[model samples]
Target: MLTTLSRIVKSGWLNFWRNRWLSSSAISIMGLTIFVTTSLLLINVLTNSLVQILRDKIDISVYFNLETTEEQILETRKSLIDLEEVESVEYVSQEEALEKFEEKHQDNQLLMQSIQELDDNPLEASLNIKAGTASQYEQIVDFLNGSQYKEIIDKINYRQNQAVIARLSSITAVLQRSGVVVSIILALMAVLITFNTIRLAIYSSREEINVMKLVGAGHWHIRGPFIVEGAFYGLVAAVIVLIIFYPVLWLLSPKMTAFLPGSDLFYFFRINFWQILLLQIAVGVSLGVASSLVAIRRYLRD
Candidate 1:
């Protein structure tokens, strides 16, 4: 068995080296396909991360009437927190709000003068409500509006920002659907390309294959070399892709960070290296092996 395996490996390597250009052509195609798939996967991951960041930033600020007591606000917070979708609720007193505004506009002398001229903190105490998902924000807002303390609840700022949130949600939905459709189409195209490449390679060796069949060689003996050849192509393409992608990402990381401040593109890619590697290898190997197997099956059955 070992001897037969060694012979198959040797033959596959010899054939690959002898027809270097053809083999390289197939590998190049596989490499490009893998690169596109990997890029899409990376984009999807980044989009999800960005969407989560946006969702986290989407909060409903429930302003309390100036006369509303701290105890009443605390009770309202507790009630909001009891909702299963509620991730967190924070209370910001009027004084704290004023301080925050002042800190934010410290450079604006005109704004500073206006704030200083106020007899007292005109801002109302508010609760910042966060939900687990963007879709849940409306439900929380509805609950707040229907609550007994609704009178003391000066306003729910959710309505003010509804249009922006709705647009973001729509965009995210379209992105997810488009990602799935594109991935499927790309995967099918890759499979077809690989299959055709394997068929061409097998056609070139048709005479030799027929001669072996006539000599009464076992099925495994006939199939082994082709399988190994396919695997070799897959491995070679995967290695090429990894080599190219690593440096490309490294070069682009800084630019990505610059475009999206606080983005962890470099760190995210580094952390997901193993997953990406495995995915690339899987796609490469599956394409190569499945294509070879299908291409050879018809000849073998004959």
Candidate 2:
């Protein structure tokens, strides 16, 4: 069994190396496919990061009435925290709010003097509510409005931020759907291309295959070499693509980071090195092996 397997591998390696131009053509196409698919995956990650940054910036601030006690506000905050949709709720006392306001307008002398003249803190204590997703904010606002403690709430700012949150929600939904559709279409195209390439290689070796069949070579003996050749193509292609990605990402990372702050392409690549490597290998090998199987099955049928 070991001897037969070694011969199969040797034959496959020779088959790959013997047809240099054809093998190169196959490898190039496979590499391009892997590169594009991997790129799309990175883009999806970057987009999600940007969306999270925006989501972080957006939250509904619920202000309490002056008569509302700290204990009451704490209870309301606890209730908000219990909601499944709520990611977090932060409580800011009136004094903290006043301090933030003053710091924000400190450069303006008139505003500073006006705020200091007030005998009591005009700023209200508030609960800053962050939801799991932009769409969930509306539900949270609804919950707050209908809660038994609603009378103590001075205002919920969701109405003012509704348009922005709605737009973000729409964008997120569209991106997710579009990413899946694009990924499927690209994968199908890659498989077809690889299958055709393998079929061509088989065609070039038709006479050899016929001679082997005439000698009563078993199906495994006949098919094993081609499968090995296909897997070799995938391995080489994955290596070439990974090498190409290093310089490309290094060059693009700074620019991408500049455009989208925290979305550093190279940094992401480095952090996810093993995952990306495995993913590319998995995709490439699966495409190559599956395509080879289908292509050879057709020839065998004939």
User: What TM-score would every model get versus the actual structure?
Assistant: 0.90, 0.96
192-273 in candidate 2: lDDT tens per residue? Answer: 7877887888788777777888898887788889888888888899999999999999998998888988788898899999
Per-residue CA lDDT of candidate 1, range 1-302, in tens?
89999998898888878889989988988887788888878777777776676777778899999999999999999998999999999999988999999999999999999979989888899999888877788899888888898899888898998988787777767777888888888877877787898889888888888999999988888888888788788888988898888888888879977865567666777898888888888888888888888888878987
Highest lDDT model number = 2
Q: Give the local distance difference test score of model 2.
A: 0.87
lDDT of all predictions: 0.85, 0.87
TM-score attained by model 1:
0.90
Judged by TM-score, which candidate is best?
2
Candidate 2 at residue 221, lDDT?
86
